[model samples]
Target: MTHPQIIARCHPALEALLPKPTAARAALPDWLRAMPSEAPAETLNGDPVRTLKHCPPFLDALSLGILIPLATDLHFDKGAVSWDWDPPALPDTLISRSPIALHLPEQATGAPYPLAVNSILKFLNFWTLEAPSGTSLLFTHPLNREELPFRTLSGVVDCDLFRDGYVHFPALWLDRDFTGTLPAGTPIAQVIPLPRSAPPELTVTTMTEAQITANRALQTDLATTPGTYRKRFRH
Candidate 1:
């Protein structure tokens, strides 16, 4: 089957500071790429599907989206936000400074807003996502990653029609006690491109007798032969 293509671009000035979109496979962390020391077992740990490197779909989604990075050093001190940078005025001199990432004065639009239902929201958009005609871009937090100090709010943009405008990201800074430099090149979002067609119909059913037998056989194979899924089932 043919694969769909997602195109990523940026302003000429940001071309160097920001990373061009790359195949998700290239972004896999070294730890995820390494195989587990123990051999396959009957449990989830032994299963290659949970073993990180052997999971294809998860890795494939990661390859989507233009990876945006911090343009400067950002620091949060207790409830106060502060940073140290050269020229000390890049936000004023630069292309676009996302107010969502900064601590603005009370009178400014950059001021933070707290929500009663969930976490607070800020106006932190930094990237513009686009897909081919008849497609859209889904922006979300990286899948299965809980180590980061912030969570990006999920969004869907009809990029094919909105290519000229930039969509900013509003993040909920999770680590209130966080302090120090959130260095540049740190991945801040994952963008997935999908077709804009309507959702397909869904069907649900119980397993048939033959399917039950097949599952039993597969279970026996999994117990007897390690990596059965890795060797045969995984695409």
Candidate 2:
């Protein structure tokens, strides 16, 4: 079966220097890669209980999309952020010189988000993303990446319709005390392409006898059988 294509385009000068967007599965966190699927836990009577490695849905979520990496190395020290990348010279009218930008605090005034005093950092995208026709792209923080010092805000764009312009990501700098280098190729965002469609119709009703029986059976399987969802339901 043929799969839909998602294309990332960038200037020829940056083709070799910039880190290309990668499959999410290829970029799993180091800690997760080292974790065992099951480990003996003293709290569980020394039983070998399943860990997140055994969770299909969680793993699927982490591997579902393409991860966009940081274009250059960034350093944070004493509340300042700096980068040392010297991108190849291009036309003056071309992309911004810096790999980052910022949304002033005033822009987020009165917003409910907690870090209102801080400016929202933007990861400037030198590469433009293009998805298949009738598909929209979801730009979000990399799932389960709490180790990062910042959290990227989420947005949706009809890449099929607006593929020419750069879609910079705005993120909240969460760790004020964090002082270190965020290396180049660190995943800054996850992009998932989805079909553009109307919202599903909502329904509210009491469960029928068959539905109740099915729910009971599912609960029983969940409690009694290991990997039931992985073996029987996951595709």
Candidate 3:
């Protein structure tokens, strides 16, 4: 679909979260060459119909390590939100949903890129059960990457928190990219394994405000000076 189509069909929340779509469509292919282009599926009715999969053009146009601050602020477990100073806790599931991953620096200090949410929304919305199972949706950058590994998660928010222009997204679902062998037609996304990734014990202590300010600096660099940094994560 074209850029206009993406904007028109996307959730208002997504539009509000991203910067303007400034990357030219022509430059996208090379920037996202590592991401898989298709999700493998056996079509029903005994015929396979190749459906198009999507990722945020924003991500497609930039490297993964540019949007780090948002990712840094998204650490949560047991209903507590805090920053850790160890290696990040990237998500892993054994089922294959699609090929996608967020990049992180080998060390706890790093940044994130401003990727398109429409593509991200497409990847995570594969979940079948949930209040918003089939809605056109996307999460805030921090919430999507750290709080909710998969974007299609659904749950209720208290009206008071939601009414004041703030909402806490408690993730109950995620479309994890599976990297293991599996039987055919498994509907749920497979858990992606992370042997090469850092261990769970790793942590990075950070202040919320400081991380956000740092993250903004990185985003600015990504938009204006695409160079000045190298790839810090391994695929």
User: Against the true structure, whose lDDT is highest?
Assistant: 2
Each candidate's clash count: 3, 0, 30
lDDT of 1 by residue, 204-231 (tens): 9999999999999999998888668768
Clashing pairs in 1: 24-63, 125-168, 125-169
Q: For model 1, what is the error of residue 35's alpha carbon versus the real structure, in angstroms, after optimal superposition?
A: 8.1
Local accuracy of candidate 2 as per-residue lDDT tens digits, 56-132: 99999999879999999999985689988898778843689799999988898797766622688899988899999
lDDT of each: 0.60, 0.89, 0.29
Q: Alpha-carbon error at 14 in model 2, in Å?
A: 1.0
For model 2, state the Cα shift of residue 161 in Å: 1.5
Write one digit per residue (lDDT tens) for candidate 3, span 137-192.
22223211332343322333322222223222222223333222321111112111
Q: Model 1, 91: alpha-carbon shift in Å?
A: 14
Better of 2 and 3 by lDDT: 2
**Candidate 2 stretches greater than 4 Å from native:** none
Kindly report which residue stretches of model 3 are placed more than 4 angstroms away from their true locations once superposed. Answer: 1-41, 53-74, 84-235
- Worst 10-residue lDDT window for candidate 3 reads 185-194
| Model 1 spans > 4 angstroms off | 30-36, 39-66, 84-95, 98-126
Provide the clash count, candidate 2: 0
Give the local distance difference test score of model 3.
0.29
